[model samples]
Target: MLETYCNASGQRVNNEKSSIFFSKGCPQVTRDGIKNTLQVHDEQLSDRYLGMPTDVGQAKNGTFKYLKDRVWEKIK
Candidate 1:
């Protein structure tokens, strides 16, 4: 369900950025799938992105902005 979609989206994003390897599998879920799950959960998937943790000592503003931008871009 929602956890699966978030995990898959995270994996897909990591793979795309080479933060994680892709040989495992593509983790991109369909837009319809995300939409349906979000509806059931009564929350948007982007909310999960907002709550994602950044690496310690990383530039919070820059990194989060980048991740958010990328996630939204992919969603589009």
Candidate 2:
């Protein structure tokens, strides 16, 4: 569906880097269904997305601090 839409609209979506995320404890059937619907892989909440943590639990652990650190390092 998405690919067809993109084709009709002349817009492209990069499937290689795209993935889907679900809330914690989501049922396996639902997860697999969504994955199949979207034609994308499932990603864990603990995994980082675009250099920032994806889940609130992981955000509180200073996982994103390194991003700020790197920016500051560059500024210095």
lDDT of 1 by residue, 15-47 (tens): 222221122244445444654544442322232
TM-score each candidate.
0.22, 0.53
lDDT of 2 by residue, 16-65 (tens): 67777777789989999888877778454446666666665645648667
- The lDDT values for all models are 0.47, 0.74
Q: How much does candidate 1 score in TM-score?
A: 0.22
List, in order, the clash count of every candidate structure: 0, 0
In the order shown, what is each candidate's alpha-carbon RMSD?
15.4, 3.6
Candidate 1: which stretches are off by over 4 Å?
Answer: 1-58
Minimal lDDT window, size 10, model 1: 15-24
In terms of lDDT, model 1 sits at: 0.47
Give lDDT: candidate 2, residue 50: 64
Q: Which candidate is the best by lDDT?
A: 2
Model 2, 18: alpha-carbon shift in Å? 2.5
